[model samples]
Target: MSTTSLTDRLGSLLMAPVHLLMRIIDIPLRAVQKAAGIGGMAAVFLAPNMLIFGIFVLLPLVINFVYSMTGGTAFFISERNFVGAEQYQRLFTCTNYLDPMSCQEDAFWTAVGNTFWFVVLQVTLMIGVSLITALILNRDLAARSFWRAVFFFPVLLSPVVVGLIWKWILQRQGLLNFGLYQFGIEPYTWLTDRNWTFIATIGVSIWAHMGLYTLILLAGLQAIPKDLYEAAEMDGTKPERVFRRITLPLLAPNLLVVVVLALIKAVQIFDEVYVLTGGGPGTSTLYLTQYIYETGFASTLRNPGLAAAASILMGLVLVVLTLIQLGVGQRSEKKGKR
Candidate 1:
C-alpha cells in the first residue's frame, strides 16, 4: 500500500466518529432551533454546561449544608438525625470570644484564631513579595526568564512535595541548621518552638506561592499603555511619580484580582501546612480546614456534623471577606475610571 493511501485511510478513521458525533448532536440542536428559535437554541447549547455545574459544584454544596444540619455517625443523609443548629451552638459556646481556650470547641476556636492571624500575615507578605518580584522582573534584566522560572518552580511542585522538602530543610539538624552551624550560629528549632514554627510556616507559604501572584502582577504591568510612560518620560517625571500616577492606577484591576485570589488561597491553606506541621507542637498551627478534617475523619468522636458546621462557618467568613475585597476593588476601579 502507498504511504499517501495509508495516511488518507488513517485520517478517515480518526475523523469518522468525530463527524458522526457532531451530526448526532447537531440534529437535536437544529430541531430545537426550528421549534423554539433563539431561546431553545441557547438552552440546547447551555444544558450540558449547566448539568455539569449542578452535578459537580451545586450538588456538593447542597449536600454539605444538609450534612451540617444533621447529627450522628450515619454516612447517609437520610439516616442522620437533624440536629438543627446544635453544632453551631457548640462552636459558639464560649466564656470569652477573644480567648480560644474558653470555647466549648476549643480546638475549633484555636484553629479559627490561628487561621485569622495566618491570613493577615500570609496575604500581606505574599502581596509585598510578589509586588517587589513582579516589579523587578517586569524591567529588562539579565536572564529574567530564568529567574522567573526559578521563582515559579515551587508553585509547580505538589503541595505534599513542597511541604516535605521544606520540612527536611527546617528540621533541627536539617540543611538550614547545617548552614547556620557553618557560620558559627547555633542550631535553632524551626518547627518545634511555637513562635518559630508559625514564622516558619508563614515564611514557607509566602515563598511557595508568591511566584504565582508575581506572574499575575507582572502580566498586569505589561498591559499598561506604553504611551503613558513615554509621555511621563517626555515630561521629565520621576520614576516614583510615574509609577504612582500611571502604573498604580492602571494596574488596579489586576492588583485587585491578585489580592482576592491570594486572600482566598491564604484562607484555605491546608495541604502544605498539614504536611509540614501536622498542626503540631500542641495544635499551634491548626488552620480551619485541617481542624475540620481532623474533626470529621481523624478525631476519636468522628463528628461529621460538627465538621460540616465548622466548614459552613469558614465558608461564611471567606464569602464575607471576598465581598469586602470586591467592594474595595470596585470602588478603586471606579476612581481609576474617573
Candidate 2:
C-alpha cells in the first residue's frame, strides 16, 4: 500500500477502539438521562389526565356514597347525620322508592334479575356467533375482505343508530312485515310483544357485536401455528376432532377474551334498549342500568341517594365478576403452561 493509504488505514483501526470506549462510557449516562426525562414528562402529562379522572369518575363515586347516606331535600349532609343502610333497605322495602304500582316487590331486584338474564343470553349468543364467523373467515373463503367488511360493518354503526334502524325494520309495517307479507304470513308486532321484544333486543345486540368479536377471534386464529392442523390431518383426525383437540385448545385464550368483553358489554347495555323499547312494553326489557338512570334522572322522585347506593352495589357486582374472570383466566394459563 501507499504510505498515505497505509497511515489512513492505521489511524482508522486505532480510532475504532476509542469510538467503542466512548459509546460504552456514554450509554449508561444517556440511558439514565433519557429515563429521568421520560419520568418527568410523564408526570407532567399525566397530571391533567389524573385531574380529569378524579373529576369525572372518582368524584362521582365519592359523592354517590356520601349522598347515599344523607336523607331528604338538602344535598349537603354529614355522614354522621347519615341514615345508614336505610337507602339499601328502602331499595327493597319501599314500594314508593321508584315505581309506585310495583310496590309489592322491589323493581330494583327485578331489574337486576332481568339484567342478569340479558347478560347471560347476549354473551353466550355473541361469543357463539362471533366464533363461527371467525372460523369461516379464517378459512380460504372467496371474497375474504368483502365478507370481513360485511360482517364487521354493524360494529362501526353507533348503538343508538343500530337500535333505531332495527326498530324500524322490526315494526309491524316494516321490512320484516313486508317480507312476511310476500310470503302470505301475518305481520307481528315485534316490539309490542314482551317475549318478542326481548328476543329482538338480543338479536340486535348480537348482530351489532359479532363483528368485533369475529375480528378478535380471527386475529387469534392467525396466530395459531399451521403445523398443528397439519399434524392433526396427518393422523387421520376428523374435522370435528381437529377442531376440538387443536383449534379449541389453542383458541382458549381468545375465547376467554371474547367472553369477558361480551359479558361486560352485555351487562352494560343501555343505548340499544333505550332506543328500541325504552325499557317498555311493561318494563319487560328494563335493565339494571336503565333502572339506575330512571331512578336518578328520569323519574319524578329523582333520588340521587338511592341511585348512588344502586351504583355502588352494581360496581361491587362488576368487580366480583371481573375477579372471577381473572381467576379463570389465570387457571387456564396455568393449564396451558402444563
Candidate 3:
C-alpha cells in the first residue's frame, strides 16, 4: 500500500474500539432518550453533582441546625438532648448586651465585638487599598507585568504561610525589633500590646487578601472604555471629574461584587489571624469563626451545641449579606433594562 493508505488504515484501527464503545453506549441512551427526552438526559448528567452537593453541603447544614437545637456535650446526635433554643438562649442571655463580661458566654460576645471591629476596619481598608493598587497598576508603567505579579504574589501563598512570615517580622526579637535595635531604639513587642495586636491582625489580613481584590478591581478598571477617557480629555475634563462620571459608574458592578465578597470574607477570617495572634493578647484578635472552632473542637470544655448555635447565627449574617447582594444585583439589572 502507499503511505497515505497505510496511515488511513492505522487511523481507522485506532478509532475502531472507540466507535464500538460509543455504539454500545448509544443503544441504551437512545432508548432512554425516547422514554424520557432531552430534559431527562440533562437531569441524568446533573445527578452526580447534585448528589455530591447534598452529601457535602445540605447534609451538614441540616445536621448543624439539628445540633444547635440540642444540648449536652455528646458527639452522637441520638445521645444529645433537645433543649429547644437553649443554646441560643444562653448566648443571648446577657445582663447588658453591650458588655461581654456581663454575658453567660462571655468569650462568644468578646469574639463578636472583635469580629465586628475587624470586619469594619478590615473591609474598609481592604477596599480602599485594593482600589488604589488597582488604579496604580492600570496605568502605563515600566515593568508593568512584573509589578502586577509582585502585587499578586501574596495571594498565591497559603494563609498560614502569610501569618508565619508576618509573625517573624512582628514578634519580639523579630525583624522589626532588630531593625529598631540597630537604629539605637529599644526593641518593642508588636504582637504583645492588645491594640497593636488587633491592628496587626487587620494589617496582616489586608496584606494576605488584598492581592485578590486588587486583581478584581484591576480587571474592572481595564474593562472601562478608553474611548470615554479620550472623549473627556478632548473636552478638557478634569481627571477627578472624568473618574467620577465615567470610571466609577462603569466599574460599579465590579465594585459591588468586590464589596460583598470582601465583607463576607472579612466576617469569616480565621486561619491567618489565628496563626498570627492565637486570639491573644487575651482574646483581642479572636473572631466569630475562631470562637466557633474553639467551642466545637479546641476548647477544654467542648460544646458542639453552643458552637453550632454560634455558627448558625454567623450563617444567618452571611445569608443576609448574600440576599442583599442578590437584591442589589437584581435592581441593577432592572435599571439596565430600563
**TM per prediction:** 0.88, 0.80, 0.93
In order, candidate lDDTs are: 0.90, 0.84, 0.93
The local distance difference test score of model 3 is 0.93
Residue-wise C-alpha lDDT for candidate 2, range 1-338, written one tens digit per residue: 69999999999999999999999978885766587686675675577899999999999888888877766645455523578887777776754554544644366777787788899988998898899999999999999999999999999999899988998899878999999989999998888999999888889999998999999999989999999888888899999998898899888888987888788778888898889999878888988889888887788867767877888898887787788779878987787799
Q: What ranges in model 3 sit over 4 Å off? A: 1-21, 34-37, 332-338
Query: Candidate 1 residues 141-190, lDDT tens each?
Result: 99999999988888998889989999999999899999999999999988
Q: Of the pair 2 and 3, which is ahead by lDDT?
A: 3
What would the TM-score be for candidate 2 when compared with the true structure? 0.80
- What lDDT score goes with residue 151 in model 3? 86
The residue-level lDDT of candidate 3 at 169 comes to 97
Clashes of each: 0, 0, 0
- What candidate 1 gets wrong by more than 4 Å, as runs, is 1-17, 26-38, 324-338
Specify the highest-lDDT model's number: 3
Candidate 2, poorest ten consecutive residues by summed lDDT: 96-105
lDDT of candidate 3 over 10-53, digit per residue (tens): 99999999999999999998998888898899988788999999
Order of candidates by lDDT, top first?
A: 3, 1, 2
